[model samples]
Target: MEKRVKERREGLPELPNAEKGKVILRFAPNPNGPLSFGHGRGVVINSQYAETYDGKLILRFDDTDTSRKPPLPLAYEQIPEEIEWLAGFKPHLTIMASDRIEVYYEHAVKMLKMGAGYICTCSADEFKQFRVAKSNCPCRDNSSEKNMQGWEKMLDGTYSPGDAVVRVKTDMANKNPALRDWPAFRMQDTITNPHPRKEIGSKYRVWPLLDFQSAVEDHLQGVTHIIRGKDLMDSTRKQVLLYEHFNWEYPETIYWGRVKVHEFGGFSTSEMRKDIEAGIWSGWDDPCLPTMATLRRRGIDPIAFRDFWIELGLTQKDIAVPLSSLFAHNTKKIDATAPRLSFVRNPDAISVGIDADERMSSISVKSHPKEDIGMRKISFDWNERGTDIYIENEDSTANADIGMRLKDWCDIGPIAEGFSQMTSLEPATELAKIHWVAKGGASPATLMRPEGKQLHTIEGLLENHDFPIGTIVQLERVGYARIEKDGNLIYTHD
Candidate 1:
């Protein structure tokens, strides 16, 4: 197996060095659960672009809203490990978004002082109906001093979940709901919180929204480029506005389409997590699912995945590639290096009679017809009753017409002819394709199915010697096979 670096990169944009040098790329996956194939697509593209531009790849865990964190104590540790595994050790650093709560609070205060944000006491029902009726919050006209007092109460836990929320003072009449004085922070109730931090207590009621936290984090960390799904494209614009308000540079964005709704069967992450907890799948890595761990277990070659997704390039059109395409690409990759072995899966051997006197002879077969050198050794012997030789049923059935040599020994054509000459120790002309192993055969062979099963077979002699394990060779007329031990064969697709 040879390790090769990528010769060309796809989905890379043409930007001047001036533009690229300022780039600091990040793959900020909210590790609420194990990442799926869609995440894999994003990861390779993000890392590839970073590699191409000689920029940094930061692995950020946007683990805010601690209430939704996985209940397992080790979930935090597993998140980074999974990210690193899928990204292939390319991230320059790993940072947790939750660790910067103080930073977000500071920015929240700054926005308040600048009169860019205010507090509201709208209940859930009131807020929903307000939006439907195209009306504004009554607190929308509250003075900054009063709003500040509300925020202070929010921080002191005076406000219950949804008792108060702080929203940016954006236009209420904006057609886009996202821009309608969107809530920057809101108190979360227990029903919405799956695994709230117990030790942290309820000292504070306000929690930053996803987009707001992400916007501030990107600017604070000097992230100059943000690649994400188009679903977040609108957020990018809002983030740009936030940066403007803070007098900071906005990161260039490359937004691709989100995974199709049908692809997910309309199952959200929350649903998937519930399914996982209920044992619907094996801890998010079950091979049945498209999670990265499952993909790897199913024999998918990550490099091929990277190449395929990158070549599709980046586009805003939502599409779902069949799982077959990925499996096919991986099969091609494995075929290039995975050695072939021989094994009779169903265990049907051609039982042909061989004579007594010639029992001690040898057969010579090419180790690998594709490669030109080594040979496998095989010998033949009569049973105590002086009769049969066993060979793979498939080889006999497929090549019955052709009398292929059993290595250096006589060619055995078909089973009928081979059995017809039972008395002679020589193989029948029609049974020339018959493969044989000596009475005391030698060679280690592993039989494998797509599911990684091993098969055992008699050893063959090449140049009067037994073949050793890992002896990749052709069985004269048989398909490619690898000699596992001195006498066993493992079947592979080659």
Candidate 2:
């Protein structure tokens, strides 16, 4: 692992000496959907930083928009669940933004009285058009009384959804487009919650912007240091402004760039969720995804993930590291720990002229080839009256010329019938390296498919080879496999 990388990354600016006691950090995920791998990175990074400084980590759900696609707060549960599952730790506190709507409005009223915020009677489309064309709204200079009346109308459900919104009223000509008078609260039915707010029938016509509410909420929660993706680094000014408006101390911020697109295309956590919901992939933990759970399911060690993540360190410049590095690093780490087992995917059985009923000829195979490990005993002979022995079509063909080592036995050349035949195995072992037997008395072996199904098979060699459970050994020219249990094993190309 890169110790220097972690040290350097953590060497960021700390809270000022005077503000040391107020060290609070928070991770606000709007549990609108299942937690994604990218979010996993954020959770770990933020929580680790909080722990480093002995600060409290608050797991807050920014579930302000109750009108989300998934109306239920999947995040409230999934966020904490995924964080615990991946980080092996939980936050000091859990809060939902919906629960704090009163607090936000109370603060919003303060801003309104300060003349820093105003309610506009602009519709959603009008606001969009105004924003696009840089047109100033007539409500921009409306009297405080008029704005308060508009807010009252919003509270009573007298105004329509798009009839009014509360804007921060920042400069439209600000150099940063994001700082250009962004909306603090808006009337919308993004998600309709039946829960009463300030009054009955008071569906929040004015919803607080995530960044704005987050700033105040984080301050209230006493977050001292905030870590976020670089994509959001640009919002620092506005957030800082909000903090100033609330007369609250702003938290120190650390920004890390987004994870690179290792493949030819970019697939973010958000994009992956969309695809999964659209039935493009299996689920959030789909092995093809870069999610933490998916990595775990794919047998990728957590330590390897941490090492890889820190190796990149905290940088403002986004990077596109090659995918090969991740795979290779995982392979090297698992080589020493993961147990070895054999699996032939597409089976091809052949008759061998070996001795029948020969129990005296014991085959002893080492559990792990690289280490001096215990061995397993095997008794191989003709299959009752048949000479059939199964082997992977891919391995059989690849080693056809350079006969493969038959576990603790002799190396034999494959017959032309194996891969050379018209309907036989291909020239390479790619066709079938993972083959298994039906369950009988043997331990249950599992074949974890790409779609997330686990097919339990039997534990035993296709030929005379024998290897004990939890043994890290090679399949004699085949790839690597981890003996999950006595009956099942997980195979990887590495």
Alpha-carbon lDDT, every model: 0.61, 0.61
Model 1: which ten-residue window has the lowest total lDDT? 447-456
Write candidate 2's Cα lDDT for 1-494 as tens digits: 75564444343344444243346778877565666556756776666566566667788877666444322344455567777765567888888777777788888888888878889887766766666667677788888888788888877778867778788877666667677667787666533554222332334556787877888788787777777887787677888767667678777787888676454255655566688789877776654666665666556655665556656667777778765666676777777654344454555565444434432344455656676655655543434432445666666666565454444344344455542221221234333233222112123234443322333333434322344554443444555554444435554434
Model 2 vs truth, CA RMSD: 6.8
Q: Residues 315-403, candidate 1, lDDT per residue (tens digit)?
A: 78888765456545655665444332233332333444455555555555555445555555555555653334444556556666554
Q: What is the TM-score of each candidate against the true structure?
A: 0.73, 0.77
Regions of candidate 2 where Cα sits further than 4 Å from its true position: 1-22, 68-72, 124-136, 190-205, 264-278, 355-362, 371-377, 381-387, 398-402, 413-493
Error in Å for residue 404 of model 1:
9.7
Model 1 spans with C-alpha error above 4 angstroms: 1-11, 15-20, 66-75, 132-134, 189-205, 260-269, 355-494
